[model samples]
Target: MRTHNTIPAFGLGTFRLKDQVVIDSVKTGLELGYRAIDTAQIYGNEAEVGQAIAESGVARQDLFITTKIWTDNYAQDKLVPSLKDSLAKLRTDQVDLTLIHWPSPGNAVPVAQFMGALAEAKAQGLTKRIGVSNFNIALMKEAIAAVGAEAIATNQIELSPFLQNRKVVDFAKSQGIHITSYMTLAYGKALQDPVIGAIAKAHDATPAQVILAWAMQLGYAVIPSSTKRENLASNLLAQQLQLSDADMAQIAALERNGRLVNPDGLAPAWD
Candidate 1:
């Protein structure tokens, strides 16, 4: 198993991608040396991601795969079984990490119930680590109470230059939970910002690279996705694009509480 105190700092995010497109993206990512892959049942492309992994011949030991359990399957009776289904679709016996996709709709399911099931799944070797996504400060506290902070590997959330989410980030950090940034580029919204664009020009990097670098520099693991091979290849180089403190502060100033992925029922009251 890929053992680490924190989630991988960078990975390939498979959100809103499916069928041949996701398959191709994963395949290209593997070919380009990406070992960590992130997917969720709600994304509907676990099977394709598995197909690419299996066909790529990458040894299971070398890959770190993460999948999220949808809120619909949060019940104790359904959690582990749904995870096993995800494993089957991903062509893997276990996932490196598993997260609760979102809090149960209207708190229909108690946090302790599903978290207990998730812990059971980890104990049973279905997932090496357990975490939660889209969780705000209050929800994070509840999750920690359910399983203890030690069991939570990361709190994956929507964080980017446009939506810094420092309050949530600070809380997770205080609880010793690593933060993973999904949609770190703000769905290409940050790419057009003059601040990010200028930083990119200053460093001879793409706007996407500037934003990804900015997030990583702040210690949040980032999973930025792309369908094109060139974008995928170039984006990985963000790891090497270090930003100065001034550059980072400039990006921080761009935060306007601009959250883009909050679904009406799916998102909780963010901090």
Candidate 2:
């Protein structure tokens, strides 16, 4: 699914946080050695994320920044321009990765149109890589057909112990597309599971660490977000936690098709 692991296995995600909260979170994550920062147009915090990165004094070359284009920007005419706006808000000339935030609702914009525009964005130096988010198996196939597998860097989706999304995962892996697991902790839901709790207790690790390690161990990239400095610091350390085969199998059984990010009108018919 990856060649040289272009996407970082762990990073910071900015979703609901805004203003000083997001600014502080990005700054804190950077101070804790986080290099990859994920944001989206709908997140409404790109400017603040840019502010934090600029203030952190971290060299631009050392960071991997990603932002997604909203569904409204899926149109061929709008996609590249929308990404240019994102670059301006991000205070950078180009983003390391840019994704189609979601499949066009009701096929309002065809995949080929937007994917071609995204390819243009890359060709014009607007982004280093291009991909999609919240895409199901069928949508992924359309994207691959539109841009070819090698052009699609990743398919960021809502995945966790609860919603293993094996159908989508298996298909993506088969197609050689990387899966970026957003809300990989299931928005903190899996942290409360007794199964995960037991594993964390056994390893003397936090439930978040156990979940993150489990995903990375399976070769999925995770972007878990936190606002508190302590939480952010501790979450970054999950990269070090390793779970045994028994632990992995235990968590795999935790799947129950639980998905947390599906939205009305915006979500596609999932795989």
RMSD of each: 1.6, 1.1
Clashes of 1: 0
Give each model's whole-structure lDDT.
Answer: 0.92, 0.91
Indicate the residue-level lDDT of 236 in model 1.
Answer: 95
lDDT of 1 by residue, 1-271 (tens): 2255567889999999999999999999999999999999999999999999999989999999999999899999999999999999999899999999998999999999999999999999999999999999999999999899989999999998888898999999998899999989888988999988999999999999999999889988989898999999999999999999999999989989999998999899888
Which candidate ranks first by lDDT, i.e. highest? 1
Q: Where is model 1 poorest over a 10-residue stretch in terms of lDDT?
A: 1-10
List the candidates' TM-scores in order: 0.98, 0.98
**Local error of candidate 2 at residue 21 (angstroms):** 0.4
Off by over 4 Å in 1: 1-4
Q: For residues 172-254, what per-residue lDDT tens digits would candidate 2 score against the true structure?
A: 88888899999898878889999999999999999999999999999999999999989888888888998999999999998
Error of 1 at 53 (Å): 0.2
